[model samples]
Target: MFGFGKKQDQPQSTIQSEFVEDVAPAAPQVTSVSSASTPSPLMSVSSITLPGAYLHPITKDNGIEYLFINENPMGVPAGKPKERMTGSFGPLPMRTNYDKLLYGTGAAYLTGFFGGGIYGAYRGLQIAQGNSFKIRYNSVLNSIGRHGPRISNSMGVLTMGWALLDNTIYSFRGVSDYYNHISAAFLAGAIFKSTAGVRPALIAGGLMTGVVGSYGLWEQFTSEKKETKIPSLAPAPAA
Candidate 1:
């Protein structure tokens, strides 16, 4: 009973138990960077630029074309010729607005005077010899004939005065004066030839007058422009 009550000791090897805990190494952390993160050259610049043709299409080689560009471009217009203008001068004060008015009107009046005078004279002679109502129209015609050249000459003289003023104040040179005077003289010659009933002389004188008058006008027009004064438009300040 005593022996049975006493327990036998177990071998040291038989009582053994060990805890083996396996901790897997933390999975390798993989951080991925995208290639798209690289900046593009085009995205670096802030502004887009276009060529002139993009703004205004050009017509060349009988076809219209637009300018094409890739990448950022600096915008600049292509060289183009300017348009022509009308009237005697540009918006500048190189010449007065009506600088050429006197000369033009004078030329027209003179031409008409000579032409009318020749026609009136020829008709006058025909009416003077006839006892017809056409004679009544003759007096009216004669009145026009007598006054026509006179009015034309007077206009020429007045235009010459204006030309002198322009030439002096505006320094237009002798061009304006020459134009007015020569036009008057030629017109006077035409009238005289017509009054004398010289048909050939009338035609020749009228043609010559027109030619010389035209030449003088053209010369004045083509002459160099003179410096002109510009009137101020500014208002005076209050005192």
Candidate 2:
């Protein structure tokens, strides 16, 4: 009876040991699961979205934050969208308006006249080196008379042609000053062709278009960046 009681006690002890081992593993697992489910305080703080935060186009998804005119907190938000900004159809303001045609034509005529007179004097000097003063004076006068009108007329015609083309473009499409300037430059190539021929015309036209277009593009890019600059979190302290 004592031996039988000993065997029965052994079986009961084995069952208790197995039960303890299984129960001990389960408690650790429960603890680990609970800890994972509860997010850390640092993580919670980082996840909170601040006011005026926005995504940047070049940044990867969820990588960076930026402010725009609408999202800037430091200043009053824009009352209207940027797309609504449009130029006027009427004459430009007094401060901005200037007579390009008059200036251009006058400048051309003056340049031509002076240039012709200078060349004539040079040629006369060359031919009259061994002659009398009277003969030299006559030679100079004759050269000036011959070349002056030709040079002056040529420059005048070119300037007028360019001005006419520019005015026409402005009349039809005056909505954007930028476009007006670009179109004028392109058309002015024709006048260049009249003097310099086809290849030169193409080169001049390309240069003008490229320069104007690049300038416009640069202005646009800078303006957009300015509009989208990040605003300060709070107003600056008054001095």
Q: List the residue pairs that clash in candidate 1.
A: none
**Model 1 TM-score on a 0 to 1 scale:** 0.27
Segments of candidate 2 deviating more than 4 angstroms: 1-98, 175-186, 189-197, 200-239
Give the per-residue Cα lDDT of candidate 1 at 196: 60
- Give a tens-digit lDDT track for model 2, residues 1-239: 11111122233311121122121212221111123254443433222221111112222223244454434544444564232222211242111122455555676788889998898888887777557889999989888877877888767766666556656765576433556656666667555664678788878677656755675676567743332111111222332
Residue 164 in model 2: lDDT: 67
Candidate 1 ranges beyond 4 A from true positions: 1-50, 54-104, 107-132, 172-239
> What lDDT would candidate 2 get against the real structure?
0.50
Error of 2 at 79 (Å): 16
How many residue pairs clash in each candidate at the backbone level?
0, 0
Assess every candidate by TM-score. Answer: 0.27, 0.39
Q: Which candidate number would show the highest lDDT if scored against the true structure?
A: 2
The positional error of residue 37 in candidate 2, measured at the CA in angstroms, is 90
User: Per-residue lDDT for 203 in model 1?
Assistant: 76
The sequence of per-residue lDDT tens digits that candidate 1 reaches over residues 1-239 is 11211112333211111111112222322212224454345531212212222233232112344455622233333444222112332354423325454544565578667766765666566557566777756765885677677766655654444334434443443233444445444555555455567775567456656755675566457645523221211232222
- In order, candidate lDDTs are 0.43, 0.50
